[model samples]
Target: MLLLFVHSKAQTVTGRIVDSEKQSVVMATIALQTLDSINICATTADADGRFVLTADSIPLPFRLIVSSIGYETVMPECASYAVGDVVLATKTNVLGDVVVKSKRPILNVQGDRIVADASSIIKGRIVTCAFDVAKYVPGILCKNDNELSLAGTMSTTVLVNGKVWNGGSVLEYLKTLPAEKVSKVELLYNASPDMHVTGAVINVVLKDNKGRELTGQVKSSYYNNHHNTFQESGSLFYTTPKWSLYSMYTFADAKSISRSQYLSHHTVGNQVYDIDVDARTHSSSLTHAVYTNATYNVSDKSNVSLSYNASFSPKSDTKGRTTNSYFSNSNYTTSGNSYMHNLHLAYVLKQLRLDANYMSYSNDGTQDMNYEKYENPTAYSYWRKQTSDRFNFSADWGFPLWKTARFSLGATYAYSKTGNRQK
Candidate 1:
């Protein structure tokens, strides 16, 4: 009798909703109530369309309803049971899974060369010049003012975004260009091909130009030193998909104060001269630069580009110098002026680049000498002029290695002849 009652109750309760075939239906409709009562409770099915109620203890004559979009409604009551495959006889709908991903840069790898992106996360505040960038890069060193050394060599060929930017010191150049514009600054150790034996090579990669429209920036700054001094500057940039343009101009006026104390002893061949002295110096300079560039898509694999850059450094100084020795003694003074001009041009290819640069720098200054000797000697007043002319040309080639690696080779020839005359 119990087995018969269980079988009868199982037939009364039913559940489940699906599409044609055995696929589950999502969000179907379900209803439940007392078997003989008109009152009912209805709710939407869950994602799986499998609904459950008090099937173990429902009053006799209780009823449950199941229905789905465009499907025949199912009615059963009084006991516990489960049913499925209430497959709809309608058309099927299909969906695809959505995916999310983002891009990032890679760091720390094994290779003979080291690439230091000037814009890496390692960069920090107080990075006002290339020296600050060098501090974070391995195998790069800047020992003193106006000095750029690489690896073990004293002379290095540095390129700014594949272009020869010889207008100023490397550190000054880095300052002129905001660090944000830098994408990577690479240090190539012992340039390959047994012949480049000069200093190591450095390439400063800048951000690429995109967008079909226009964009740029303008900025100015002030700099101060230990002495009461100050300087100011401004710059701008713009770009487009078919062409690009950039122009920057900077100006500085400054003064410096310093004190020095020293003692020395000299013995040369058969002569000896010992001297002690204290000295102070004050100097200033006015400098500025303007640059412009453009590119035209001559073909798909090749493009033509031209650029011009000019800067002026007019230096004037007032120096007071004194000399004291056993054989002769003198107090001297010097005041002077100097200026420089530089120009450049280039053409580029997909795998190669060619460029030429010329510079004419002149220094015409006077060295005034006054003398007071007690050793039976005489001195004369004097002045002098110095001049320098420089020219440079280079070509670079990049070759792909087995479609995975890349090799870049380049050659540069530079000549700077300088002369000084005194009268």
Candidate 2:
């Protein structure tokens, strides 16, 4: 009698993970285990949610478990060489996992985004607004008074309550927004296509407050060097179930002194010539701006919003002096003013915006020069006037394709005309 011994060959299993909407779920953890609770193999899904795992020779009926952030877990039982798709539902709400008196982690990693618990992290800290709390966030830098960057990238957009913040300058608005109103802050490094923005963004989720309420803030700053700079601002908001209104005003008075030096060396026809010059400028300006916005909720799915913004620089004056080593010393002065206005309207996810801008500039000044090399003095005076009118119109609309995705299209038109005279 002849007896033959055969061994079973191990088989490979491949599958793809996706969300309920059939979108690929990347960075998901997939594990295979034996029926008796023995670990066999484990792997992670690639960008396309494809994974491959090998079954052992014993083939004891294994099961697969797939899990990802912000999604429900999936478990499928199979034998050998099970290849197909695994679907996961979104984790919108969990009743069994609720703990009312528990503290959330300061940092949580969601796919391509970091959710920070600003309320919990800023506890016991002197944070009056989000700007004050930004310094504590990881991988974020406040480069200047009005600039914020994520890691190394400088371009960043800010959103409040899941909607784009159309308020004035981000730095100015942040100063007036109360920190306590923030529930969480999401840092999105890899934004979705619907976001439109190409760089990192910060999304601030505000608390869900019902009923009517009023909130506002005031801010002022002063700086003194050779000249003095002053800034004052105020913001106010009133909210109700049907309508809400927000307004902000700012005033700035600034004076500055600048100095520059220039040097050049050139050769012409076997002759070398060198020139050195030093220049100094003194400037002062006054600016006033007002921004107001209002929204009326027509229904749960739609709303109407209107916004108006106006800015004016009453006076801007500049005085400059230049001293040249080989020629003359020149002095001059100039002054001008400018104004702008913008009006915006939106219906739900569609917006129509218009802007009317005007500027009137007049420079009545004199240039006096002393030619040191020639021992001669000369003077000249001139008057110049200029005015400009510009108008711009734009319309944008967004179509919701998925729960978290959208298709956006827009159009814009701008026109400007100017008139000038010189003497």
| Candidate 2: regions farther than 4 A off | 1-105, 108-113, 158-168, 189-198, 203-209, 260-277, 349-423
Model 1 lDDT on a 0 to 1 scale: 0.55
Q: Which portions of model 1 show Cα errors greater than 4 Å?
A: 1-112, 117-119, 122-135, 138-157, 192-197, 212-226, 263-276, 295-301, 323-329, 374-379, 395-398, 401-420
For each candidate, what TM-score against the reference?
Answer: 0.58, 0.58
lDDT per model, in order?
Answer: 0.55, 0.66
- Cα RMSDs, all models: 28.3, 15.8
Best by lDDT: 2
lDDT of 1 at 383: 75
lDDT of 1 by residue, 98-179 (tens): 4332111122211333455565523434554444554444334456544454433335666665455655544555555655
Q: Mind giving the per-residue lDDT tens digits that candidate 2 earns over 55-104?
A: 54436466776666456566677765665889977766546987333122
